[model samples]
Target chain A: MSSILKVQGINKHFGGLHALNNVNLDVEQGKVHAIIGPNGAGKSTLLNCFIGRLTPDTGTVDFDGTSLIGLKPHEINQTGVSRVFQTPEIFTELTLLENVMIPALAKRDGAFKPSLWSSMAGETEIRDQAMNALSEVNMGGKAGMTAASLSRGDKRRLELAMALVQNPKLLLLDEPTAGMARADTNATIDLLKTISGKGLTMVIIEHDMHVVFSLAEKISVLAQGTVIVEDLPEKIKGHPKVQEAYLGGAHL
Target chain B: MTVEQSKKDKIMVIGVVLAVLLGPIILNPFGAGYPDLLQKFVIYGIFAIGFNILFGLTGYLSFGHAAFLGVGSYSAVWMFKLLSMNIVPAIILAMVISGLFALLIGFIALRRSGIYFSILTLAFAQMSYNLAYSVLTPITNGETGLQILHGDPRVLDAAVEDGALPVTNLFGLNMNATADVSLLGMDIQFNAGYYICGLIMIVAFYIALRLFRSPFGMMLKAIKTNQNRLNFTGVNSRPYTLTAFVISGIYAGLAGGLLACTDPLAGAERMQWTASGEVVLMTILGGAGTMLGPILGAGVIKYFENIFSAYNESELMDVFSFLPHWLQELVVSVSSLFVGEGWHLTLGVLFMLIVIFLPGGLMEGFNRLVKLARGGYRKDGASASAAGKVTAE
Candidate 1:
């Protein structure tokens, strides 16, 4: 498979602390890839660097063969790379449909026009597209409901729907099932299966072993900012370095 | 999609149209200089509505909006003195100039958020105010204010026609004469200026409504709620916010132009920080993010400022004329403390109370009353529905 994302020699430092040191990652197109590590691992920092939330002191990242260094977060998003925060960063004040519609509207060609006025039904098309996106996660029924009222799992699902609406080329989810209940975690795993079935490229950071094993075709074990092992989940399960770095915390 | 929903929408539209058409007439029945106050209310209401679009919806607190208002007033007055007495051209010029000024200010202020943006706007407004009062005296006419001179040039519509200008009114509507009739023993008279303001306010209101429903508005709200998320979602929030700021500044300019048209004067006081603060109060008191809230807030504030501030001991005595001498005297003496100049004190108290107990402003109180009257099984839920979403952990 062709490489959709390539990270080369990325190093980040916070004063005396080396948060990420010479980390390298490459994601193939249309594959479900998971990154797992201990709490202090640089999983989130790596994700942030990809989305331009934080710039690495030294290194480069390329998305779809385009260099992503020095780009703003929004510019990175515009380049077909989208991320979901650990804590579902959905717009709580807006309706679920509106929450989805916002990203959808941004993706449309004439999103920047000042005087663009559409009829109520035409606006409904935006909502319909949002609903269609939601339907992928089986959340279409909650379209008109306020996003704040949704359960944690539902909010996560809604965030997924919002990301899906953008039709991004690479979706990065940071600890997507971190705070989910056991049932919700399994449901998220199912949702990931559904998403990956569509041949969409995804990079997920998950601590949940059940979820990672259920969805990831390949797993990368990270410790203290650098990748220690990259192998199939079955091989990673038995790797000595992976066990020493992550096995104690894997129950989470 | 439902019949009831469609009917409710129809009612809302009709109610809005009626209010726009007959607001001045219905609000001031006694007419005791109330029409003038009503006009001021509507004009300022339009201004506040525009201001709310930026501050309320976008979570931006601008301290330089009055600069736009002042610029509009100055431009309008200059137009009247140099070109024509007609308000349309003056207002258009005012809006355009204000928008241009906003574009400049927004570019700088939008580089920062929170307190930095506030201070930047304040510094810019203060600079403009000082320039207008001193350095720009040749154009602004200085502290003495700008006025229409008798020998000023007349261009286009200002030209005398058929020995005299053909009795021009707002949009050619007969204002000084209405159906050539009388109502309730008083001649029903309207000024071309009043109609012009009403028409402009209607346009402003419509524009505000369109903006509220637009995708840009949605993005603005998102920016307010979560800037980081919006940035990651591929929206350049700076440009979006700058555009909103410019649009709001134009609205403020239009209001200022209308004021100059009514009074034929533009003064440096219009650009004062206090004036900017007044619009902020109006937006907050009316319900910042709501559509009709700022208008209601402006009406309330202006009513107190103009109508209530004008009431004196004599007016109080006249109101209590039917009462006995001692009671009238007592009433007058007591009421004197709360009238005239005391009106600001009353407003200050009201503003403090609203901010303390009703942070959502008059809209929250009104929504609560509406919920109480509805008396349904979901009454408890309904009251909290319109209140801002309480933070959920």
Candidate 2:
């Protein structure tokens, strides 16, 4: 498969601490690529660089051959890269349907459209699409509920639905199931598998090994501020370098 | 819009139109049917409505909106000075000039959010007020304000009509010209200026309603809810916020223009922070995010400022005359602080009460009352309580 997202010679620093040191990654098209690391492993920092939340001191990030190094977050998103945030950054005050509708509107209207005179009610197609996205995440029944009133797992699902509504070419998720219970995590894994079956490309940053093992077509183990291993999940499971990186060379 | 949303919008428009049309008759009972006060009601209602478009919808607390209002007034006055006494040219120019001014201010102020945005707007407004008062004295006339004078050049049409100051008019119809009628022992005066202001306010209300139902409005609410999420959703929030700011600024300008239409004066004091604060108070008191809240807030505040503030000790005594002498004396003494020149104290107390008890403003209180009338508190009470917390920021 052709690589859809390419990161080369990426370096980021927060004062004296080097958050990312010459990190290189290539996420192939139509695959679930997971980046797993222990605490303070710079996983989130790397995700931030890709999504324009942080500007790497030196880097080249190319999504579909377009440089995403200097683009704004929204502009980058417009380039067909949508991100599901770590802590489920849904529009909590808005309804679940609205939370999904917002991204759909953004996708249809571009980054900025002065549609002041146009009624949101008339956007039946967009609304249907948003509802479809919500249903895909098992949130269609609670579409009218205010998002803040939703449980933490449902909030994560709603956020995932929000990103999905954008129909992005590449989806970036930061800890998609970071705080979910085991059942919710399993459900999310099933959801991810269902989505991946549609041939969508995703780059997920996760700490959960079960999730990493279950859905990831390819696993990239990150240690300190660099990728220590990049291989299939089965190979990554028994890789000595990754084990040493996680276990600090202690026998397991 | 959906059938239901459109129906609601239609109802709102009709309700506003009726209120504006029958305001004189309706307000007559309250002794606030005078042309001047009615004009103030519609004018400030427009102002508060416009302020809500920004603050209520987008969650951007602009403390410098009065600058646009003042700009609109000055532009309208200048239009009258240079062009003619026609209210059309004045109002149009006022909206355009204030829109441009808002573009400039919004471009700068929208760079920051939260309290910093408020402070930035405040600084810009204060600067405009000072400039209009001092450096721009030649145009603004400083402390005295800008008004049509006898010797001023009026290139369009006649400079003077019958050797007196030319009154502002719409195609020869004088704004100050009033038609008085007595209905059931009550005097009702309908002035040309008040009707024009009222009509414009109806249009403004319609526009505001359209804005609220529009996709643009949803995007703004999203910005208020989670701007970061919006950004990641491929939506540029800055332009949406700036647009909201400019739209509301133009609304303030329209209000200012209406003010000039009724009174034909432009003063630097109109740009003062206190004036800006008044619109904020109106929006919050009425309900920041809800339609009709700001206008209702404006009416209540203006009613108190005009009618309640005029009551003297004698009026107070007359009101409490049914009580015993000692009780009446005590009531009048205590109520004295809330009426006449001290009416602001009453308004302040009311503002405090609303903010403390009903943070969603009067609309939430109204909603709660309706809910109570229907039944008791519902399960969605948590969400109802959570509504104001997000937008209040």
Candidate 3:
């Protein structure tokens, strides 16, 4: 399989402390790639670099053969690299349908196109699409409800619907199940598994071992800003370096 | 998209149409039924409606919108001087020129949002005011103001041998010409100028209503809700905001043009910071985000201004004639501070009370009253919003 996203020789530092040290990753197309590590593993920082939320001190992030080093967040998003943040970034003041429709409009119309003459109530196609996406997340009944009224899990699902409405090439799941209860986490995993089955590339940064094992086809173990092992989920499960990286520090 | 909702909206539209059409007759009781004041009502109604589009939809608090009003007035007067006394050219030029002016100011002011954006617009307006007052006097005519002169070349109109200034006209109809009607022993004067402004005001209100339901309007509301998320959603917010700002500016310009069309004069004083502040006050007082709020606010403020400022010591005595002589004297002396020249002080107090008690403006107050009538009264905005929330249970 061809790798859709390739990170090479990444190095980042914050003042005197090194945040990432020569981290490298290869995420194959149409596969679920999970990046697992401890709390300060630089996983989120790496994800931020991918999404253009942060500029690495030195690195080359290649997606679809073009450099993503300096693109604006919106420009990077336009390249079909959409992100689901851990905190769930959605338009809280808008309705769920509106929140979902906005991303769909962006995906269809590109960065900015305001149809002043066309009323939202008349956009039956977009409304249907938004409703379908909402239904996919089981929040179809609440499409008219304000997103601010949604619970934590519902907000995340609504956010997922928002992302999925775009039909992005690469979906970056930043701990999609973080802070979720077991039932909700299991539901999210099943939803992600269904999405993964449809041949969409996803890069998930997760701390939960069960989620990492159940979903990821391939695993990359990260420790102190560097990948310690890159292998199938089965092999990466019991690797000595992976254990040391999870338990100890600074050992090859 | 609900049928009930759409039906209600249709009712509102019909209501607004009726209100605007019958304004002169309805306002006869308020002593604001005169031609000039009625003209001011719809003119400023258009102004506030446009203001709501920006501050209401996108949450951009501009403090320099009066600059466009002033710009419109100046351009209309210039058009009357150079092109024709016909208001069509003047109003059109006013819209176009104000739109361009807004584009220039919005392009710069939109670069910084929140208070910085407001301050930038205020500074630009203050600069425009100062320029029109001092340096641009050749065009603006400085302190004396720019008015149509008898010998000035009104190229479109025939050279008047009568040695009098030409009045603004649409085709052959004079703007200030009034048709008085006696209904139920009360006289109602429908002025040609007032109807011109009134018709335009309806169109403006309708356009604003259409925009509120449009996807573009949704995008604006999204920008207001969360601009960062909007950017991340791959929508460039700057252009949308700039477009809204310019549209609002054009609206202000049209209102200004109508001002000149009714009374063929333009002055730099219209661009004063207080004028800008007044539009903001109207929007907030009516309710910034709702459709009818700003226009309602403009009417209420203008109504109070006309009523309170028209009262003198003698009028006060007439009002308090039932009270004893010494008590009447004391009351009139105390109450006089909030009337006549002190009308602004009354406006200031009302504005503060609205901001404190009804943060959502008159619209929320009306909503709350409706809710109370229906036995569903909630204490505040938070609880009112929360009352409608759908839980997962």
Candidate 4:
């Protein structure tokens, strides 16, 4: 499979401290690529760069051969890259259905079309897509409920629904299963597995070993701001470089 | 939308149109039956509604909207002075100019949100006020205000019949003309100017309703709720917010133009920062995010400004006539502080009470009442909606 998102020689700094050090990644199409690391390994910082939340000090991030550097977050998002924030950045005051509809509208309408006169409820196609995305995560029944009333797991699901409804070419998830209960985490993994079967590319930053091992087709272990190893999930388990650089701790 | 939701929307539009058409009759019981007072209510209602479109949806609090209103009034009045006495041209020019003005100010002021945005708007409005008061005297006429004079160019007007001040009109329909009808022993005066302003306000309210139900509005609310998420959602909030700001600015302009049509004068005081703050109070006092809240807030505040200020010591004596002489004297002395010249104190107290008891504004108060009437079902949603409004900052 061709690489859909290619990163090379990405470096970032905070004063004297190096946050991301000459990192490189090649995410393939139609696969779940997991980035695993200990805390402060620059996994989130790297994800932020992908979504244009932070600019790398120096390097290139090419999505489908288009450079993503210096683009505003929304501009980057408009280029078919959608992100699920670690903390589930859902619209707290809006309904779940409405929450999902926004990104769908954004995806179809581009950055700004000024769809001022069109009634949002009248966007039947987008609405149906949003509903389908919601029920995909088992949230179709509570579409009318305000998002603020959602539990953390449900908020994460709604956020996932929001990202999915966009039909993005590349999905970046920052800790998709972080803070989820065991049952919720397992359900999310199953949901993600089904999504990956549809031939969508996703890059996930995760701490949960179960989620990582279950869903990731290829694993890239990040340690000390650089990729220590990149290989199939089966090979990644006992790779001595990954074991020494990251997995050397009690985690299997 | 569901059948019930659209049905409610239809009813709401019908209700607003009917209320505006029958404003004089409806306001008669409240002692605001006169055409002039009713004009203020409708005009300011338009102002507040437009203000709410900005402050309500996207959570951008602008303290410089009065500048747009002032610009609209000046544009309309200029149209009258240079072109015609017809309000159609005046109103159109007013909206267009104010929309441009909003685009300029909104472009600059919308750069930083929250308190910084508000302060930037406040500064812009204050600067405009100072300019209109002094530097722009050639156009604005300074403290005396711009007025059409005898022999002044009114190219579209038919040669100023015997130097009588030209009355504002819509295609020769007299704006200042009024007719009185007695209903149930209460006299209600319906002025042509009031009806024109009333019709325009109804249209404005309808547009606001459509905007509220639009996808653009949802995007705006999303920005208000979580802009960070919206950015990642692939929507650029700047243009959306700028559009809302311009639209509301145009609303303020429409209100300003109507104010000019009502009296045929545009003054610098109309652009004062305090005047801008008044729209903020009107929106918050009504319920910033709700459809009908700002109009209701404007109506209540204007009513207090006109009626409460009309009260005097004699009115107090008549109201307290039933009490004993000593008690009446004591009551009048105490009550007098809250009326007449001190009516602002009464308004302030009332405003404080509403904000404290109903942080969601009068809409929340009505929601509570409606919930109470329905045995308090869906109890969580009332507080949920209220919580939505309180997070506007």
- Tell how far residue A20 is off in model 2, in angstroms: 1.4
In terms of docking quality, how is candidate 4 classified? medium
lDDT of 2 by residue, B89-171 (tens): 99999999999999999999999999999999999999999999899999899999999877666678554546877889998
Runs in model 4 deviating more than 4 A are A247-252, B381-393
lDDT of 2: 0.90
Error of 1 at B299 (Å): 1.1
lDDT of 1 by residue, B1-393 (tens): 223434554565466567756664566454532446656877898899899999877999998899999999999888877776666778889999999999999999999999999999999999999999999999898999988665666575555534532332344453232332355555444545555666777677767766776777788888888887777777778888989999999999999888887777899889989899899999999899987789889988987787678889999999989999999999889878778989888898899999998899998888778767988535433433332132110
CA deviation > 4 Å runs, candidate 1: A110-116, A119-121, A247-252, B1-10, B30-33, B157-189, B314-335, B377-393
Ranking by DockQ: 2, 4, 3, 1
lDDT of 4: 0.90
Q: What is the C-alpha local distance difference test score of each model?
A: 0.80, 0.90, 0.89, 0.90
TM-score, model 4, chain B versus true chain B: 0.95
lDDT of 3 at A195: 91
Error of 3 at B283 (Å): 0.5
For model 3, what is the alpha-carbon lDDT of residue A251? 57
lDDT of 4 by residue, A1-252 (tens): 899999999999988979999999999999899999889999999999998989999999999888999999999998889899898789998888889989999999988878778897589889889989998888887777789899898999998999999888998988888778889898999999988999989999998878899999999989889888899999988877877775455455
For all candidates, state DockQ relative to the true structure: 0.32, 0.57, 0.51, 0.52
* TM per prediction: 0.90, 0.96, 0.95, 0.96
